[model samples]
Target chain A: MLTSAQLDKPIVDSDLQREIEHFLSYEAHLLDTNQLEAWDSLFTEDGMYWIPLEHGQEDPVGMVSIAYEDAILRDVRIRRLAERHAWSQQPPTISTHQVTNAIVTAHDPTAGTLTVRSRFQVVEWRKRNFLRHLAGGYVHDLIKIGEQWRIKLKRVDLVNCDGVHDNFELFV
Target chain B: MAEADPNWVERLVEPARVHKAVYTDQRVYDLEMERIFGQAWVFVGHESQVKEHGDCWSTMIGKEPVVMTRDSKGDIHVLYNRCPHKGAKLTAEGCTKHKPMFRCPYHAWMFRMDGSLVSVPHRHGYDGTSFDPDDPQFSMTPVARVENYRGFVFCSLSEEGPDLKTFLGGAITSMDNFVDRAPDGEIEVAGGVQRVMQRSNWKIFFENLNDTGHPIATHESSFLAARKTSKHKLGGEVPFQLHIIEGNGEAPEFWESLDLRAFDYGHSFMTAIFHAPKGKISEDYKAALDTAKGKEEADRIVSMNRHNTIIYPSCSPHTGFHQLRVIRPISINRTMVEIFTFNLKGTSEEYWQRTITYSNIVNSPSSTVMVDDVEVYERCQEGMESDGMDWISQHRGEGRDNLLDREIQSEGISEMPIRNQFRAWSHYMLGTPASIPTGGGDS
Candidate 1:
């Protein structure tokens, strides 16, 4: 499956590269620090965050995805996580995420976008030991906002995304 | 001799309730495969999954590896994955084209898709003996019965039982309405499959499909956080994400008004939540329906607003969401749920995307809503293991279940659904072939 030949692959300049690194770092910080508020700011107003249920998923129109979220749904999830009575968070998950191999593999300078391929390993801990190693390529679509750069879309493709999961409390 | 517990099952189940041991006991888990999961009409993959010849999908029935395959004649066959030559697994996992026959990895014994012994490598060795390949015992064993309803394939392991249609009974409507929502009045297996493992009893998950009492209390923290985030993060303007979060926090009256109906075989479905304002996509979808299905038919289809319809011990079809969470009990303490997304045959692509979106937010491993639910289920498993209490309560609105012909109705928060399931559980555990209670004498 050609994953967004135009979208999955983008062009990145040095400035764009720097912007993506910061965007990637900030996104990780928001989730790891449990500062979902800050993370919510990363998306474009109409941007989508989609996680396909199947490998090599091509289109999202008629097919069902594992997760496809707009701004509103994303907020609800963040809200649910922060709720004091959230039963799953009786002992909230503690995680230290390591984001590595940030490469600007593709760029779309005219579109103001760049796709970065990166590997990540997050060690998440809760009451009992739940440590998962997730390595994925991140497709980042960025747009310039005056001097700052904001994330339009950031899709993470986990290497073992197809495996049975317990629950994704925090981000990868 | 490590004889299986014959009386252990009888002791675990009661007329009106079930002991948690039926859920968490290892000895009982083995018996379930032989009795319930083995005999019951368990759902395999949809026919669309293996539409072509040599196409096969491997899944488990209890502890057995049952393969749903398409033969050369385009007939569907469910066969045991074992090869008779050396007792080796004949096929790899997932769907794969095995050509005309499957060859065992150990000693090469090839079998046709219909589970016939096509060859056994050195056939001359068996010529002197009575190991004739034509005998049924020499071939891969086919399931007792296989039936398809609206492209959904279900197989039963027992030779004697009510056919799949009679077994599905009223639940067939859910599958019909499932594909009928497709403008073309058909649906296909599409998108992807999401699998989630739960550290609790399979019954607990089944009960939660319509368990209205827990959403407010169990999901309080998540919804509260959703509310708080709207206030602090995005200036109090709720989005679809936040809407789903707070949707779980509906008022008690709202829950009480909605109808919950249970069928004889422990199958049940709830009327859609009375809230959730019709949004842009839904409005667009309604317009499309008016064009495709016309005003009356479309209205009739839309009027059947239902949540999850449990097909009893196997899967829960969310008609509104266009997904099915197929449950497989891996062990007494663990259950595996595979989420399959379906494409409405004639609807626009965007309509399906919304369904997928709902699946991700509500059912995905990273779902904020389901995370908390999974946690509580695990907690229940842990709590039940302790000797503090022997019986898990199902007394909520016990005697108050409203009875009707072929169906029982209860209030939104009533535990009648759980009690209804236990009624079936007792029947199944007691080894009664008629698991569906007649609901007349002593129930």
Candidate 2:
């Protein structure tokens, strides 16, 4: 089971809190503006983007998931979205993600790693008529390399994770 | 029983094309729900899903609520998921494990796993009424017929029809090969299920299963992305992950080289375009298979590789990938697809993991490949609403199908499968027997 990082202590450092909040907002901004390539760049080389189908899904392998993608799979999706004949994206799905309630549960100063949990609600509009409302919880495992914090894992647990869904053309 | 138009269905479905009403009209959809899905042996849950006594798995057989349950005697039965008194569903949707007995939340009516009425809350209230506890009407009703072929259970609403084996006809080989690949000669439904909703008619999705002509055009975006990623990042050696995607970019000649076989009852399958991945995990899996069922038998089982085997309007099983996609038609313009990945028993954990990877990459709604297919299906549904055309064409390779005793073989890119499906559709809707139509290539 992939659990959240240990809760070392509540982040009392104002500077560290501000940096984490900025990073979360910027990530949401990239997704909202359809800057997928830039969003992809925010991840580490071996990072994973996972959306578990089960509520408390422990293993991404040996079980089915909505998504359990590595860098190559993520890049393939990004490249396909750029294709002119990508039929699903003909009109393009426009989304606005509202991410809030970010709580830094754990911060390892020595290893430069942090585990942050946030809540998000995304409204996606497509085909000029269909509007989908999706809400989920996000868990990010961030690791700092040099000066920048890169995502080692981004786990999304949707409220309706076990329900039927339409094709998700874009990342949530 | 009376005919509304007498010729309403026959006029719509011809040898080469079908009227747009078949895909768009609500009347046609209603008729199909009653005729085709009502009579055909539809796939219910597998036996493994309801292995324990009192375990129940709920699903629909053409919008009819039904549940598959294992009784105390170890026999599995398919029953209508409704309360005998109030007509409310017996169990909630999906699987409910170890359900001691079905206690209806509606009226507190209880039933055994075999659907026999056990007790009711107000037992003394029906003293003088026609509600005889010993009568069959008081119990949950089982479907007319239930058959389990190698643990894959199927149900038919109508009592009279060809048996499951006969209905499957030449397509039975696909199911046989599916179970034979298991090291222990058994496979079970495992992992989890992913459901995808498509805003299109159910037939459109079925037609696309063997429509070899579409991949090169429909899936160009995904295949091209896979190629670019392989070339730049993976040093031109496509891994199994990208190999499945890039395989869609095969040359036109490659698709034509495939062997396409269409059976009676709208069933068909295409020989796999993907070669077995040459990797350590796969090698170990093959060795295990060889050990279980002698080397020669294992070789024969592995050699029968296939991509999509359509068991007609219900499910499509990919024998090579260990995936089964169940098709559920929600309404006229809406369809729900549930994908299930199987675990071949006695295989390594890594072998099962590969199945999970394949499902996540190819069958999930979030798949880069299926999104395009779903989009085009929706486009066809929307375009059929246009008054520009009356008929959708299936003229490719029309006169070139090879006639056989029970099945037809055609070129991979041929539209024979679509035509064959309409042939079955006309039979079901027109109330004709499912015996091969005179001109439909069956001798």
Candidate 3:
């Protein structure tokens, strides 16, 4: 329902495309380096981070999700990760993210909003030898404020979102 | 006949301590699959899961793959998920629509929604053979017994035992309160299911359901983090999210103040840890319940708040939160936990959303609280394999429990529930009489 004709129009503005790509790469860098507090600052005050439990899940409130965090809950998550007694993170998870196929799917110049879709694959290692590969598609709703973009919503749809999973200790 | 020595099964459990073999031995797990899971009432699925006719959902009762289906006549059936022609599973582990008939992918053998064989391809090939379509063996076989209490369905693999109601006994009140909390006196399985794998024995997780002493020790990281966040950001008046986590760090005296009740057949429940907070959401939910039922009845209903009710060997229901955690054993050292959230019909959307939020924060595998518990359980599984210890202790307030007619009441911090579980475990593992033991308080 949020689709628009701008999806077909290739982003002709090279400057805007470069800025969007830089923003995504920087976000991935923050996540991979465990800069969660700085990463949290990239979102608006009312921003949401969601991981849908099912494919094509549209409503987080009407259904369940793997991860749905607002600002307060996200802060709690960051705090927990830093706790000394957090046993699951005794040897904290190390991750590397590969992001590609970034596309500006929609743009509303008057509203100062743009929708970007990208594909990502993340490899995480923890507990000395345990490793996992997570592949997903990311959808971001960014609003421009004073020549900078802030994320209003970020939704991640994983290929195995509905599969039985082990403890997810860090952000994907 | 018997696999292991009968005396050894009895020796694995003692009054105040149990041997490590009960958890680490594959021989014991096999006997449990036969005597315990074979006779006990295990949860299959909820009726809401298969509402429409020909809707089928595959799940496991013990180690067997079974399917729960709704037929054209609105009758529900629990059948084995194997094709009679071959031993292949008919469907995967999920909900699917096989309207009118189910055609086996192996040989195209067709069967009705009720698991009756309708037809098979190349029927003339079996004309001279002993295969008869009318024979019961040629059709899908149902479990020994299937019973539905309210909308929840349970099946027993063995034919001889107490009925479902008798098996549930006094603990049935928890199930009643679960459904009656709905304004319309009904609830449906909604949202979605979240599954997590644990590297521990299934009984270890079951025993933890009512163990009040471990929350502060196991979940110290989560609660301390929440407390720090509340102090730094929210000025120390914790919100609902932080409140849930912080409550786990309650002092030992606080936990001792609450009461624990254990019923027959390894069922038990503890008093609510935190009362329903006073807020707009609570007010609105109370108003809706009052509108559906009178204020007096509504007051009576919500006042019966319980924390977690263990239905023994299958599922644990948190009535106050509208969630059920189903326990499925994979192997001796592996377990699967499936959490399901329910929606009370005729309630406000905001109420249901709160339930979903609770599930995400408290029960999901990504939950801050559960991740630590999972780690501890895994550590327990690994530690028991060492040669250092032989018996695990259950000596915390062991003999200080009151025995009633059909229930056991003890201090919330007591290990009465774990001891009581071993009582039922001994009964099942030894193939003893199913009748409830009388006048035995503590030994």
The residue-by-residue lDDT of candidate 2 on B236-321, one tens digit each, is: 98888999888999999999988899888889999998766898988998999999999999999999999999998799999998
Computed on C-alphas against the true complex, the DockQ of each candidate is 0.55, 0.86, 0.77
Give residue A12's lDDT in candidate 3 (0 to 100): 34
Could you say which candidate leads in TM-score? Answer: 2
Number of clashing pairs, model 3? 0
Candidate 3: tens digits of C-alpha lDDT, residues B109-197: 99888889999888899888999999989898899999999999999999988899989987898999899899988899999999899
User: Which is the better candidate, 1 or 3, if ranked by TM-score?
Assistant: 3
Q: Give me candidate 2's TM-score against the actual structure.
A: 0.97
lDDT of 1 by residue, A1-172 (tens): 1254644444546675676777778788888898876777777787767666556666654555555666766766666666667678778878777777677765656766555667777777887656556666666666766655666766767767677888876655
TM-score for chain B of each model, two decimals: 0.92, 0.97, 0.97
Sort every candidate by lDDT, greatest first. 2, 3, 1
Candidate 2: list runs displaced more than 4 Å. Answer: A1-9, B1-4, B437-443
Best by lDDT: 2
Report the Cα lDDT for candidate 3. 0.88
- Residue B142 in candidate 1 has what lDDT? 93
Candidate 3 segments whose C-alpha is farther than 4 A from its true place: A1-9, B1-6, B433-443
The whole-model lDDT of each prediction reads 0.76, 0.90, 0.88
